[model samples]
Target chain A: MKKRAVAYLFILPAALVLGIFMFYPLAYSFMISFTQWDLSATRTYVGLSNYRALIVSPDFWNSVLYTVYYVLGVLPVSLVIGLGLALLLRDSSMRGVGFFRTIYFMPVVTSPIAAAMGFSWIFHTQLGYANHLIDSFGGEPVNWLTNYNGIFQLLFDRFGVELPRVLQGPSVALTVIILLGIWQNIGYATVVYLAGLQGIPQTYYEAARIDGANWGKSFRRITLPLLSPTTLFLLVMFTILSFQVFGPVQVMTPQGGPLQTTSVIVFRLYQQAFAFYRFGYASAMAFLAFSMILIITLMQLKYIERRVHYD
Target chain B: MTKRHVTLAIKYAVLAAGAIIMLFPFYWALSTSFKELRDIYFEPYGMFPTNPTFSNYISVFSKAPFGRYLLNSLVVAAGTTFLQLVTACLSAYAFARMRFRGREIIFFLFLATMMIPQQILMIPQYLVVMRLGMGDTYQGLILPYAATAVSIFFLRQFFRTIPKDFEDAAIIDGCGPLRILRYVFIPLSKPALATISIFVFMWSWNNYFWPLLIVDSTEMRTIQLGLALFRTEGGIQWGEFMAGTVISTLPILILYFIAQKQFVKGITLTGMKG
Candidate 1:
């Protein structure tokens, strides 16, 4: 009993935190989600109406697609780059590998909102340095955010040789945000890969070299296969983080402006709850995003665990 | 070339290019923030200015309550880190060494809550704050973060690695839990505490959404949110925007510099291999 009391003391602070901070809010959000509550409305229970509206709303659906794009656009690109760096920098023989590793990891620690603000300037269509390069090549300055329609059509057609005139993909504004997302997050994946790489005993690679296993074969035969667990964890975490991406959209591309092309699900959720004062609908939208993330993380974990070599 | 040398070259080449792409924004922000309006506006590709100016940094301060925002960020970040360490240490020490009923289940529950990505809680958390009338208050912003699952879990893991003999000695000396915590456990776990401190500081400082929901007062806005407000000041103040970016990112970068060696070692040692 005395030992149990001591153990209970250890767990006390965390339990108290969850009670007041987590569960209370969870119950609070659930209660708020089923009502006619807005900034001025009464808190009367309205059954499934907010969920119904969310299903029918085009804005909600736009966010759904935008949410999908968040996964496709940022996740794979960052992972490939991160894994590639991991392979390069993990080698002890590589000069300046530590310097390069620090540089890549720097952005992950930088504020995402600040990074987005800086990117907004970079992708600024008129009088931005990015467009200035294009102008030097005898091309007109393009409004990256304003050209959202053209981006989708252009991307689907295997990228545009000539910029098209249809709204699609992530808008120029959205692209800048995506770029910031990619930059801030790639460091995390890279570090994970580096850690995994470090875990692989030097003997394996040395043994491969002794048997005349070439670099390409050694990497394919040894490194890639061994690094599966770290890669899996990265994928799962990335999926979760990507879905909850809200701050950049809120701060960097507030209002999802330039025709609402950047209306990601979390942004949409915020707008619904706070801006539109549709608390119920916002809660439902939040749940929808939560469910999508949960399903995706589980799927990735299961799929990757099959190939993960624990030893 | 031997296969080893060839692969090494490819590896370094890819890493160099990748690192450049990752860091270009910082350079761009610095260069643009110093250029005159005409230079950034007309020349656009002005990577460097003939005469760099401090006007952007000046304008950033003049434009808003930037200094207060910085203070607010520091207070919140410092408070969160301090509180998280305290909570994490106490709880983690118990989890690491205590014999108690229902301990595993409760710790698992805390871990489970972490898996529930925070967006799901945003609205509800906001409502609770609203009901409690903590909107726009620094305490409102700092209080919830006093306990974080990740920090606790990491701390507990580290505490487990410390030799149990230390605890046995403390107990022999008639030292209670808190005394052992202060003198023995704390000194022994300085590494774990430092690692968690940097992490908690970084996350608390960069955290935007909760601060956005609760801290509507410009006086209490964090540097991250203050930078956002600076951007909304109705002008394309590229100079100041970059200046503000620099201001917001500097603390996190500094924290990284000081504790990074310990931070990296902690990550590797903790089996956070992910």
Candidate 2:
């Protein structure tokens, strides 16, 4: 009994903090999702109304679409680039690999707000280096962040082929944010993948080489399968994280860009709650976003847990 | 050179190109921060500043309480880190070493909190903080984050790896459970402790959304919030904006560079475990 008392004491402070902040807030948020409160009045219970409104609202749905687009745009590109960088740098004979690794990981350590400012300046239409580079190359300056044209649509139009609006793909504004997302995350994925690659034993590669396998063959036969677990982990992590994209949008395009194209789910939640003061409605939106993330993560974990080889 | 050596050279070239792409923004930010407004307008893409000046940084300090924001950030971050370490150490020890009723369930519940994204908790937490009159207060920011699930999980994992013999030896020396934790576990888990400290400190220092919600007054604003205010308050003043960014980023950059290895280890440790 005394030993049990001591153990409980050890966990007391943590439990207190968690209870007050995490558990209580979560429960409170869920309850608030069903009520109508405008920060100045008594809460009036309107069960399912907030969720129903969120479901039917075009703004809410557009934010959802934007969130999905962001995940799709950022996740795979980051994974491929990260893996490629990891492969290039995994060679111990590369003398300056450590220096490059540190350089690459610099943005990962820096605050997103700061990184977003840099991106905002770099993609600034009037004074941006991007436009300068284009102008120097004898091409017209592109409205990188403000242009709402779909990149593919623009490319097809250049060749005199017009595509439908639905098939136009991600907007130019969203693409800039997507590119920033890739830049911010690729270094982290590369570092993790590099660690994963280092953990793979050398004998497999050497044996493959002895058996007349080329670089490509050995990579396909040995490296790909060995790195699948890391890849899956990165895929799920990046998916969840991309869903929470806010800082860049908040900093770069405070008004959600030309047509509200970059108003991702979390950013929308922030706007609705803080900007519009629709706390109850925003709470509902928050719950829905949370549900989607929880469901996706749980489903992925269940499906991928068996495939991830510990060794 | 042989074909193999040529391929190695190509690899280095590729890595170097990627490094430049990764680092160009920092280069540009630094250049813009130091360049005069005329230089900025004339050569936005210049490799080097033609005329370097500290006027932008000077304006940043004169415009806002940037130094006060930095001090507030330092206090919140250090306080949060310190409290998190104490709580995480105690709780993780109990979860890892002690055998009691509801241990597994309690630990599982704590672990489950990691799955709940902060977005979902933001509104309610803001309300609770406001209701409790802790809005714009240090305790509101520090106390909530002091029981971080990631830190506790990390510390617990580390504690489980410490051999039983060390604790057995400590017990033989008439040390109580607290003493055993203090004398035996903590000293051995220095690396893990340092890892969590850096993680928590950096996180608190760079926090945006929570601080944005909680802080309404200029005196209570964090460095990140201050930077956000700078962005909006100044109208397209790229030099001072970038200068403020440099100020916000430099301290974390220096801390990261000084403890680069430990930071990498901490990230990889969590990354691989996940």
Candidate 3:
């Protein structure tokens, strides 16, 4: 009993704080999802109405679609770029690798809001450097952020070929945001991949070379298979981080982009709860978003655990 | 050149190109922060200012309560880090060294919460804060972060690696659990504690989403929130905005430089075990 009392004393503080902040809010958020409780109004029970309403709500669905678009847009590109950088810098013979690593990682440590502000300036319509580059290339300046139409559709439109709305790709606004996501995350992925690369033994590559495996063949047979765990690790971390991407959207395009093109689920949740004061509805949206991320993480963990090799 | 030399050249060329792309925005921000508004507007593609000025930095300080925002951020970040360390150390010690019933279950519960991202709890947590009348205060900003599952988990892993001899000796000297933690575990786990502290500090320092929700007053705003406010309220004053960005990020950047190893180790550990 005395031992149990001492143990409880140590655990009490963290459990209390987490209970108040994490576990209780989780339960409360679920309870609030079934009610209509605006911040100022009386609570009224509405059975599954909030969830049912989301099914038909275009805004809610648009948020989901944009979020999925962001995940798909940022993940593979950053992973490839990160792996490339890691491989280049992973050679023990390489000099100035630490300097390059520090340079690549500077943005990751910097404030995302500050980074977004800088990016917003980068994509500024007229005075932006991106448009200046386009002008130098003998091309028309692009309004990167304000252009609400899909990039593919816009490209097709330039040729006077009208494609169906359904076939249009991610909006220019979302494309810029996706680009920013890739930029911000590639450093993290590179650093993680570098650490993983350093862990792999030199003997594996030596043995492969002794078998007369060429560089490309060795990379395919040895590097890819060996790096699967790191890849899986990054995928899960990036998925969760990507799902919670709110700062950039909030700072750069506060109104969720022109025509709601960049209305990610977290941004939508923020807008609903705080901007519109629809607590109950936003709680339902939160539950849905949470469940979506949870399912993805679980699926990835199960799939990767079986496939990833320790050696 | 030989094939190996050619490949090495290609690798350097690729890394150099990637580095340029990664570093350009930062260089742009720094350059633009120094340029006059006329240079920014008239010479849109100006890579370097012809005549740099401190006018934007002057403007950033004058236009808002930037100093107060900096103070607020410092206090909140420090407070959160301090509280998280205290709570995490206690819990980590219990989980690492204590022999008691339901300990595994409790530790598992803590670990499970690590997967529950902050977005899921934001609305309800906000409501709870408001209900408790803690809204618009530093406590509101710092309280929710006073305990972190990740820190506890990380510290517990570190504490377990410290050999049992030191802890046993401390206990034999009539030291209590907390005393053993103070005298034995803490002295040995400095690096891990430092890693967790830096992680907590940086996480809270750059935090935006929660502060945006809770802190509505001008004086209560964090530096990141202050920058956002400067962006929207001050219009496309790129010069001042970049200056604010520099101000907001410089401290953390310096910290990163000073503690680069801890930051990298913490990040890698977070990736693997987080």
Candidate 4:
């Protein structure tokens, strides 16, 4: 009885803090989602109207679409490149391996706002290094951030191809933000993949070599299968992270970029809640985004975990 | 050269190219920060600053309350980290060792909080803090993050791995539960404590959204919010902006360089478990 009482005493502080902050606020947020509050003295309960409006709102859908584009753009490219880097640097005994790892991981440690600032300077249209490089090569200076045209449309323009609006890819501005995401994420994925690579048994590789398997054959037969768990982990993590990307979008393209092409879900939520003082509407949007993330995570676990090879 | 040597050379070459690409942004930011406005705008810009000056760095401090921003960030981050450590240590000790009612269920509840996205909680949390009259206060900034599921979960796993013999010996010496935690578990789990400390400190330092929502005055702005707001207000002053970025990043970068192994291990530990 004394021990159990002590245990309760031990948990008291944490329980108080978590209960007051996380658990209570979560319930309060849910309750607020059902109301119309504008930071005023009173909140009038409206009963799902906020959610219904979000479901039919074009701006809400646009943010979701752009978020999906950002996720798709960042995830696969970073995974493949990260994996490749991991493979290249797998031999820890090799000279400069640590040096290379440190360089790659620097951006991961870098705050997103700082990274965005660096990228903004790099891609600045007139007075930027990117344009300087283009001018040096006798090419036209690309409007990297200001251009509202989707990258697909921009690419197809040279071929006299008019891509439909829906078929058009992420706007050039949003693509810049996506590029930043990929740049920061590649290092994290690389490090995680490196750890995964370390767990593979050397005997497995020796056996493959003895069986007359080449590098490509060994990679496909051994490496890919062995790294599936790591891949899934990275996939879930990157998806959750990419969906909530706001700092860079806000820093790089302040007003959600040209035509609001870069206004991701969190950015929209922030604007609704703070800028427009539509707390109820923003809470509804938050729940919707949260549900979407939950569903995707569950779906990934259910379907993707089946294929994950665990030793 | 032989095929083996050629392949080695190619490998090094590729790694070198990748390193250059990775380091270029930092290099550019550093390089631009030192340049005069004339040098920045001059046609046929030099790769490195021809006439490097400290004017931008000086102006960054002069033009805004950047020093105060750094202080605010330090206070909030340190305070939050200290509080998180205390709360996490206590709860994790209980979850790891003590026999209590509903222990498993409570542990699961703590784990469930990890999945609740901050976006969902931010609105009401803002309201709660404001209602409590902590708006724009350090406590408002620090207390909400005083307990995190990540730290508690992490410390619990570490504490579970500790040998039972230590606790038994401590108890034999007439140490109570609190004393055992302080004298035995904490002292023994120095590495684990350090890992969590660095992780929490870095997280608090880099946090932008919470501070943005809570901070209303120039005096309370963190380095992140200060830098961001500076970008908008000090439009097109790229030199000053880069200077601000370098200053804000320097502390974390210095910490990373000093504790590179801990940073990597912390990431792997949290990344794998969480």
- lDDT (Cα atoms) of all candidates against the true structure: 0.78, 0.88, 0.88, 0.91
lDDT of 3 by residue, A201-299 (tens): 899889989999988998998888889999998998888888888999988888999899998999999888888888899999998888999999999
Considering chain A alone, report the TM-score of candidate 1 relative to the true chain A.
0.90
iRMS of every model, one decimal?
Answer: 2.8, 2.3, 2.1, 2.1
Write the residue-wise lDDT of candidate 2 on A1-311 in tens digits. 99999999999999999988899999999998998888876898999999999999998988887888889899999999999999888977768888888888887778888888998899889899988888989999988888887778988987898898556767899999998888888888999899889889999989999999998999987898888888888888888888998887888888998798889999999999999988899999999987998888888888887776666
For lDDT, the strongest prediction is 4
Deviation in angstroms for A44 in model 3?
Answer: 0.6
Candidate 3 deviation (Cα RMSD): 1.7
Per-residue lDDT of candidate 3, residues B38-154 (tens digit): 999898677898789999999889899899999999999999999999999999999998999898899999988887778778988988998999999999999998998889999
C-alpha RMSD of candidate 4? 1.5
Off by over 4 Å in 2: A159-166, A302-311, B271-274
Clashing pairs in 4: none
Between prediction 3 and prediction 4, which has the larger DockQ? 3
Question: Which scores better on TM-score, 1 or 3?
Answer: 3
> By TM-score, who's the top model here?
4
Output per-candidate TM-scores for chain A, rounded to 2 decimals: 0.90, 0.94, 0.96, 0.98
* Model 4 CA lDDT for position B9: 92
**Candidate 4: tens digits of C-alpha lDDT, residues A21-58:** 89999999999999999988898999999999999999
- Please say which candidate is ahead in lDDT: 2 or 4: 4
